[model samples]
Target: MSEDPSLHQSHPDIIKRLKRADGHLKSVIEMIEAGRPCLDIAQQLHAVEKAIGQAKKTLIQDHLDHCLEDVVGPLPSDRRRTIDEFKEITKYL
Candidate 1:
C-alpha cells in the first residue's frame, strides 16, 4: 500500500479487472453445468486466466513502483537485497 492521497494507485484498475474475471469465472461455471463443449469452456477459461494474470502483474508492479520506491537513495545492503528479491519475484507475475 502507498501513503497519503491514495493507497496503491493501480488498485482501482486491478479491482475492476478482478471483478470482470469473477463474472467470467461464474459464466464458466454455468457453461460447465450446461454441458458446453470442452474446447469452448477451455477457451473462456484461458481468457479468464489471462485477465487474472494481468491484474496480478499490475498489482505487483504498482507496489514496486510506489511503495518500495519511496525509500531514500543509498539503501543499506540488506534492504537493497530484500528489494531486489521482491523485484525478482514480481518478474513471475
Candidate 2:
C-alpha cells in the first residue's frame, strides 16, 4: 500500500461525515425502539447510508489523487493501474 496522504486534509472531513452518520444511526436505533413508522426509519437509514458512502468516496478519491500519486509518480502505466483499481472499487458503492 502507498503511504497515506496528508491526513490533515481529508481526515477531519471524513471524521465529521462519519460522526454525523454515527449520530444518525443512533437516532435510527431510537426510532426503532420507539416503534416509529417503517418509512421514517427507512428514510433515516438511507441518510446514514448516504453520509457514510460520501465519506468513503471522498477518502478513496483523495487517496487516489494524493497517496497514489506519490507512489506511482508520473508513470503512465502505474497511474492507469491506480485509476483502474479505483474505478473497480467504486462499483460497489
**Whose lDDT is greatest here?**
1
Clashing pairs in 2: none
* Model 1, span 66-85: residue lDDT tens: 66677545688987888788
Tens digits of lDDT, candidate 2, 1-93: 235536737878899999999999999999999999999999999999999989988888777667766776676785688677875686566
lDDT of residue 72 for candidate 2:
62
Total residue pair clashes for candidate 1: 0
Model 2 earns a TM-score of 0.76
* Candidate 2 Cα lDDT to native: 0.84
In candidate 2, stretches whose alpha carbon ends up further than 4 angstroms from where it belongs are 1-8, 76-93
| Prediction-by-prediction clash tally | 0, 0
Question: What C-alpha lDDT does candidate 1 achieve relative to the native structure?
Answer: 0.86
lDDT of each: 0.86, 0.84
- Candidate 1 error regions (>4 Å): 1-6, 72-92
Clashing pairs in 1: none
